[model samples]
Target: MPSSAGPSIDTITEGGRVTQVGEGQEAEESVPPVMTFGAPTAGEILAERYELVEHINNDSAGRLVWRGVDVVLRRPVAVVLRYPGGDSATEMLQAAVAASRVIHPNLVGVYDAIDEAERAYVVREWVDGQSLREMVADGPLDPGRATAIGNAAASALAAVHATGMVHGNMHPGTVMISQEGRVVLADARTDGADSRENDVRAVGGILYFALTGHWPHAEAPLRGATAGHGRAAIPDGVRDASGAIAAPRQVRAGVPAYLDDLTMDLLDAGIAPPPSDVLAAELGRLDIPIEEEPYPEPAGPLRFAAETGDEPSPLASVGGRKVAIGIAGLLAVALVGLLIGISALGGDDDPLQTEPVARPSSSAPASGAAPAAATRKLSVSDVRIIDPDSKLRDELGGAERVTDGDQDKGWDTDTYTQPNFGNRKSGMGVWIDLGEEHTVKSVQVSLSATGASAQLFAGKTDPPSTSAGDKLLFTSYRTNPVGQPFEEHDGTTMTFNGFDADAKYRFLLFWLTALPSNDRGYQVGVLEITVQGS
Candidate 1:
C-alpha cells in the first residue's frame, strides 16, 4: 500500500494508528483497518465512474488525495479516499453533502460522496492551482493581491453561512489560487466544534498570512501543526513579550492602515468580527483596482452598524466646546434675525431693498432647447440571449427572467471550460430592445458573482432573433462600445452610468467579455437588467 506522511501526528498508538487528541483537535477514535487487501492501483475506477490517475498526497487527517477524472463527464476531478468508511468517514461525507448544497464561485464544487462499506471516497472539482501556503512559501503577497484573495474567501464563506452551515476547515492550505487568478476555498470539515464566527475570523488569518507570511499562533491550530511536532510548515506569527501576535502593518512595510485595522480587528478576541457577508462587502470596497491604482483611496475604518442595529450619528461624539461654539453661532444668527425684524417694521418708509424674483414662464422654451427630464425606470419591451457560437442555443432559454424584476431568478450562461468561453466564441450577451427610442441615462446590471468582464452597447437597428443575427450584433457592439467596459469588476452589481442622456437609444446589448469562475467552470448569472431614463 502506498503511504505518505500526513499532518504531524501527536501520538502513535499500540497498533501504529495516529490519534490526535487535545483542544482544537477533531475528536476521532482509533479503529482497526478495514481493508486487508492491496491498495487501489492507478487507473482503477471507483463506482465505475471515477478513474484515479495520480496520487496527490495524504491530507492532515490521513485521507488519500488523488487526481482523477470523471469518465462520463470527461472532466478532471479530485478524489479523496478513506479506509473503513462506514463509521469513520461519516463526518467527511456529511461535510461534502452540506458543501455541495451551497454553490459559489469561490468554493470547490463537491461532486459526489460515496461509501462502499469497506472504504469511502469524495469527488470534487479539481483546481489547477497552488494553495496559499505554497504561494507564500518564498515571501508575503502584495497588499492588492492579498486583499483580492481575502475578498474571495470571505465571499465564499458568506455563501456557506447563508445556508446556515459552517466551514469548519479554513487555513492557508485550503485557500487555493488558480492559474487563472480565481481564488477558491476547499476542504470543509463537519466537526461540531467549529462555528461560523471562527470561519469569519479565519479570513483575517488568511490576510495576515498573505501580508506577513506568518500564521497567527493564537488562531485555531493549523491543519498540519500538531502538539509535539518539531515544527510546522508555516512559521508562527511574530509575537510581543505580552504574547500578542503583531499586526500585519507591524510585521511588514507598505501595509495600508485601513487594511491593517481590519485584519487586527478580526484577530482581536475583544472586538467582534462582522458577519461574513458584511466583511466580504468591506473587503470588496477596499480591493483597489490593480491597473488603475496600487493602493485604494483611504476608506475609513469599518463600522459594523448592520450587525449592531445602531445607526450612529455622524456628529454623535462632538466635544462640549464645539457644541458650545455651535450654540454661540446660532445665537449670533438669532440677533441678526432680531435686527431684520425691526427693519421689517419700517419697510414701507425705508423702501426695503430686495433682489427681483424670477417667475415661471407660461410660454414654451426657446427653439432647440429642451427641458431637462426627470429620470424614471424604462420598461424593457423585449429581451433575448444572443449566443452566436453555440449551434444548440441551449443557454438562451431563460433570457426573459433577467428583465423580470426578480433578482433571485434570471438567465445564466452554460459552464465553460475557461473564463473566455474556452476560445469557442468571442463572447455572449443579452440583447434588450425598448419599444422605441428613448434617452438612456444609465444601465444597471446585477450579476450573481464578481470578477466578470462586461460592457454595454447601444445600436440603432435590431437584428433578427437568430444565431446569424447574433453574430452580426456582437461584431457591431464590439466595434462600437457605448460606455466604459467593466474589466474584472470586483462587485457583482455594475452600473454603467456614462450613457449619453441626450442621445436616444432603442437597442442595447449587455455583452459579457469574460465570465467569472464558478465551482463547475467559468459562468455568470445576469440577475436583472434595470434601465433608467426619461
Candidate 2:
C-alpha cells in the first residue's frame, strides 16, 4: 500500500508489473504500438539518485533534457534522456566518457551515465544560462560580442583538439552564456563525424550569425537554422539568388572590415582553415585592452658606422634601438621612392630627375618624422560607460569629467557585489576618442583608488558599446593601489608607456580588468587621462 503523500503506483496489467505514475503516464498508456516506450515522468528517480523535476527541451540529436535533482547530493543537474535506445545508448555513454576525460572551464562537466535497459540518460552539470541560439532569437548580435563569443569557443575547441579529440558538434545550439557573463561551449558530441576544420569553420558561422542573425554555413546542424528563404542552407554558404553569401559588412552596417574578412575566410571552403591554436592566437592578438602600461623612457635614436676607422660612429653602440629605427627609416625611404615614381609617371619626363632621388642619410630621421621624443597631450572626447544591460547602466557625466584636469571630480563605476564586477557583465571601461590619429608614445591615468588594473586599446573604429577584446593594442597593462603612493608606487598616478611608436592611435580605451578590493565594494574613479603622442 502506498501512502497518499507518496507517488501513486499504477499496474500495467499486460506486463503484470506496478509502475510509478506522473506527468508522462497518459502518453505512455495511450501508446499501443509494437515499440511501446515509457516516457519519464516528473519525480521519477532513475538510477536511484537522479529525480526528474521538469522537462526542458528535446535536442535536435533526439535527447530529452530534463531539469533534475541528484537525490544523493541534493544538487540540481541536467539529465539528457533517450528512450527506446540501444546503439544510441552506447554512443551517448561513449561520448559521456570521452567528455569526462577532458575537463575545461568552457565544457559542461559530466556527472554520470547509466542505462536502464529500456532507456538511457547522461547526467551533467546544470548551466544557469541561455544557449547561443536563444540569444540571437530576437535579432543579430554586435560584431565585437560575436567575435568574443567565437574566441572563447575556439579556445575551448583548441584544448579538445590538443588531445586529438573533436567536438564533433559545434553550433549555436551548443554555445552557452551564463548569467555571470561567462561564455562556455556545451553538449560536445565527439564521434569523429566532423573534422577540426569543420569546427574552426563553425566558429565563423557563429560570427556570421551574430553579425547577421543568420547562420552562414548551411551544413551546420542547428535547429531553427535552415538554408531556404530567410535562413542559411546546408553545405553551401549563406547565399542569395546570385549564389554568393554576403559578407557580414554587406548584411550589417557597422561590422568592421577586418572582422568581415576573418569571418569570410573561415567560411570559404576555398581557403584552408588555420589550426585551432593559430586561430586562437590570432583572435587573442586582435583583442585590444584599454588600460595603459607604464611608459619607459624612449631609447636613443639610430646611429651609423664612422667613415674613418679610428672615429666612433655617431650611431655606434645602438643595440636593439638601432634595428627598430633602421627598419623604420628603410620603410620611409621605400615609401618616398614609390611616391616619387608615381609622381614622375604623371608629370612630364624630366631628364634632370630621371633617377630616383637620394634616400635620406642612414643617420637622419625621415623628412616626415616628428622631432625626436616629441610628445603632445591629447584631449579625449565622448567618454561613456560600457555597461551592456540597459536597465542596469550607471549614470555618468559625458567624456568631459576625466579630461577637465580636475582630480576632485572624476567618473566612478557602479558599485558591484564582487571584485570582478560580480561577473554580471564584462568589466566596465572608460572610452575616449582622440580628435584625430597620432603616433602615441605613452598614457598616464589618475584614479581614485588603488589595486584596479586596466589595459590600453586603440583603433580607428568607434569603440563598440561593449568592451571588446579583439580591439586591444598590447596585452601589457598597468595596475596599482589608487591614492596610496608607496616607495616606488605613486598611489594617485598610473603611468602606461612603451607604445609602438610606429603605429598610429586615434580612439583610445581604458578598460578595467580587475577591481582593487571589495572591502569598500567594487568601484573605481577615472580622475584624469594624460596622453603622450605626436
Candidate 3:
C-alpha cells in the first residue's frame, strides 16, 4: 500500500479473500491497468481479461493482490491503487471517479483509471468473509447492533458526504463481512473534497469501532491543529450540520439508550444517518433479549512457524491498506501517521529518509529498514491465533492466552477493566487463541501507552457468549487520543466466514482517559500477531 506520495494512493490485498488498492483508470486505456498496493490494482479490464492470481502483497506503496477473471464478469475484482506518484493519472482519476458517482453502499466501486498505467483502480466487491478486525471481542455491540452498524456506515457516509465527498479513511478494516450477513464499505482514498473533518473522524471511528472493540480518535491530541481535527471529533471545515448526538449509552453497557442516543446523533450530528436507513434500523435491532448464554463451537487453526518480522515504520504499516470504506467498501488508511516520516501522511514532509534508514529506535526496530517497511508483514511470532481459541505457539506477552480447544496453554484474565465510558481514564482487556479451525484474515496490536492505547478483539466465546447481533463475533475499537503506549494500532481483521477450526480468540483492549488531569492513560506491549498462510 505505497502512496507515501512517491506514488498516488496504493492499496489492494488479496487472498484474505480480496482487498483493494488499484485505481486510476481513465487516461484512454487500451490496457496497462494493473497495480495492487503501490496503489491501483484493477479496473479497466478494458474489454474483459484477468489473470495474475498470486502475489498477495507489496508496499513500496502498492501491490498485494490476486487475479483470475475472464469474461461475463464471473468473479475476482478487488483492486484499489492510485500510485502514479504526486497526483495526476488525472488527479487519481478524479478521486476514483468521484467515488464512482456517489453510488453509496458503504462506498467502494470506482471501476477504472490508468492513463497508460501511471495507475488508478477501484473495482471492488470481493469479500469472502472475516473482518471487523477479525471478528472483535474485547466486548461492545448490540446497542441495537451498534446503531445498526453505525447508522448503516453513516448511511454510506451520508452518501459520500453528500457528493461534496470525504470518507478520507474510516476504519474497521474498511468494513466488510460478507458470507451473507453483508456490511460492506471499501477503500475510498481522497486527497480532497474538503475532507469533511476527515469524514467526521471516519464516521466517528466507524461507530466507535462498531460498538466498542476500540478506536476513539487520536492523531495525538490533534497533533498540531487546535481549530481543526481529522480522525474522531469533527472540527475542520465543520458540518454534521446539526444532527447532534452523543449517547452510546453514555459509552457502553449492553447498549441501547436509544442506541446510545442514536449513535450520538449519528456522531455529533449536523445531519447524516441514512446508510440504507441505518442498515434497516440497526438490522431491526437484531432480535434482542438473551441472558442465558450458551452458544459454542469456536476453535480452529493452529500450526506456527512465523518469523516474518517487518515494519520499520511507514507509521508501522499504514493500518492495513485500501482506503475507501463502507457498507462493504472496506478501507484501511487511517493509522493516520507521519510523526516524522512527515506530510505524506501529515508529518508534513521528510518522508522515510531512504536507503535502509536508521535512528528511529522504538516505533519498531529489532533490526532496521522501517518506514512502512514496504508493508508490515505481521509480527508477535506471526501470532498464529487470537480469537475463540485455535492454538498455535510462540512467545506471548501481556498475558491472557486461553484455549478451549483441549488442554495446552489455558489461562485467562491478562487484563480487562472497562468501568467507565468516558473515552479515557482507564481500560484493559486481553485474550488469544487460534489452534484448529482457521479462516481469520488479519489483526495487529502494539501500543505501549503514551497515556494508553490498544484494541483488537475476535471472539465467538471467551467471555463473549453472544449478542452484538449474534452469529458469534463482530466488534471493533480504535483509540489513542493521547495515551501513547509505544503506539501501533490498526483495524479490520475482524471478519468471519469460518471459525472454531478448533477455537480462536484474541483481545488486547486499553484506554486510559486523558490521565493525570488531561494526561489520560493507555499502556501497550506485545509487539506482534501476524497471521496469514491459508
Candidate 4:
C-alpha cells in the first residue's frame, strides 16, 4: 500500500492476480497521469524522483511538451505526451526508428522514446528559448535577420527530405529559437499526412509567418513554375503560374525582389529545400544587380566622348588639344552610319513602317555577324549559382525509401512500388481504392520537374512484367539536362505500348532524381490522385 500526502490519493494496480487478505482492506492512493505541465502547481506527486519545470507549446494534435525531470538525474529534459494512432508496440518502434536516422544541427534531436504501460513518451533536448512565433508576435524581422532565419530553416527541411522522409508537421510554432539564437525544428513529425506534399505547403507557411510577422499571407504557391488556373491551386502570397511571391515591394519598399522570389520557391519547395537556407544563400546575391550596357558614346556632337568642357574631340584638340583620337574617330564613324540608317528609315514620319531595304556596307564590312559569345542567362531550372543542398541537408529529417518492389498495378497499401530507375530515386505513390481491377492499356502521368526533379519511364511489358528489366518501352527527359533549372513551370509525360494494360497498370511511375531545394516531390492529395481502369 502507498501513502498519500493530501486529498489526491495515488494508487497502483497490477494485472489483477491479487491474493485474499483476511479483514485488512484499506483505501489506496490514486495515481495521476505521472506528468504535469510546466511546474507542478499543487498536484499529487506519486514519485518524488522528478519535478515539473515549465510547459512547452501545444502540438498540432493537442499534445503538450513539459519541462520535467528525473529527480535522480536532476537535469532538464523535454518531455512530450504520447503520440496517438500508433496502435501498438510495432508502430511506436517504426516511428522511433524513422526519426532516429535524421542527424542535423538545425533539427530538434530526439533523445529517447519511452513506452510506459501502453503510453508513449518522448524526451528531447531542452531548448531554453522562445519560439519564432513568440518572438515575431510584436512585428516582422529586419530584412537581414529574416533572411538568415529563412536560410537556416530551409536547410533543416532539406536535410529531412533528403532521407526520403517528411516532417509532416513543419510550421513556425514548430521552430524553436535557442538561447544562442539558433533555430531548430521543434519536432520532426511523421504521424500525419499520407503524402509528403503536406509538409511542403506547411514550410511555406512557416517562412511567410517568419517574414510577415503574421499568417495573413500564409498561402504560398504550390510547386509549378508557371502562371495560370490549371496550376492555380496555390495559396495567396504566391503569384500565378510562377512560384513567385506577391512581390515584397508591396509589403515594404526597398525589399529585395530576389529574396521575395526565393522565399516563394523555398516556401513552395517543401521537403525539397527549406526556405531558410535558400534565403540565406539568395541573400548573398540579394543586392539589386547593376546592369550595364556596352559603352554608349555620349549623345552630344561627335566630340562628347572626348571633351571635358563644351569641347570637341581631340580633332578639336588639334595636335595636343584637338587631335583626332580613339573615341573621337569611333564617334565620327558611328555618326556617319546613323545618318545612313536615318535616311533608310524614311525619316521618322513612319516609325513602324521603316523597312530594312539596305544590303549595304559590304564595302564597310559585314555588320550582321553575331557579336562575340553572349553571356548565358541562367534559367529557373539550372541556376546552381547558390546551391544549398549541402547546407540544407545539415538539419537532416529527409525522407528515406524503405520499401522498393515491383508488383501488378493494383492498389495495395501493403504492396510497395519501385521501378527500374537510373542515377536517382524512383517510385510512384497514390491513394487508390481500386474496386474490381480491369485491364490498363494506357496511363496518364503528370511528371513534375519543378518540385521534385525526376525522369519518367513508360513501357509495356508482356504479362506486364517489371522483372529482368528487359521490357523497354519509352523514356522521356533530357539526359544531359536531368536536374538542370529552367525558367518556366511545366511538366511532360511518356507513353508505353506493346504489353497488356491487363495487369492493371492505370497508374505510372515517378523517378525522383533530385527534390527541388524546397523539398518538392511526388505527392497526391485525397482527391488529386486517381488510379483508372481500362
Best by TM-score: 1
C-alpha RMSD values across all candidates: 26.2, 24.8, 21.3, 30.2
lDDT of 4 by residue, 1-534 (tens): 111100000011113211110000111122122233332332222144435565433321233345566566666555444333234333433454455555566665444554543344444445455556556666766556565565555555555555665554344444556667766653343443322434433544565555665442333221211232111222234243543344343455543433443344333221122122222333322322223332111111110011112232211111221111111011000111100000000001210011111111121213684322211111111100111122222211211111111111222111112221122223222211123344422222223223333332322222222222211211321121111131222322222222232243322332333333223322311111112223
Candidate 2 lDDT over residue span 424-460, tens digit each:
6555566677777776655667777766766655555
- Cα miss at 17, model 2 (Å)? 34
Instruction: Sort by TM-score, best first.
Output: 1, 2, 4, 3
- 1 or 4, which is superior by lDDT? 1
Candidate 3 worst ten-residue window by lDDT: 351-360
Per-residue alpha-carbon lDDT of model 1 for 1-534, expressed as tens digits? 111111111111213332211112221235222344557779999988999987654443545656789999999866767776777666555555555556577765556778876887766666565667667876999899999999888887777677776665566755667667877665444333456767777888889889999887433333334442211446888887856677777788988765776676566543345567767866786777666777853423352111122232222222110111000000000001100000000000110101110111111235796544534467889999999888888888999999887879999888899999888988889999989998765677879988899988887767897888888888776766764677887767665644553468888999898999978999999998877665
Provide the clashing-pair count of each candidate structure.
0, 36, 179, 67
Evaluated at residue 501, the lDDT of candidate 2 is 48
lDDT of each: 0.61, 0.50, 0.33, 0.32
- Name the better of 1 and 3 by lDDT: 1
Could you give the candidate ranking by lDDT, starting with the highest?
1, 2, 3, 4
User: What are the runs in model 2 whose C-alpha is more than 4 Å off?
Assistant: 1-38, 60-63, 84-88, 219-241, 288-534
Candidate 1 pairs with clashing backbones: none
TM-score between candidate 4 and the true structure: 0.38
Question: Per-candidate TM vs. native?
Answer: 0.50, 0.45, 0.25, 0.38
* TM-score between candidate 2 and the true structure: 0.45
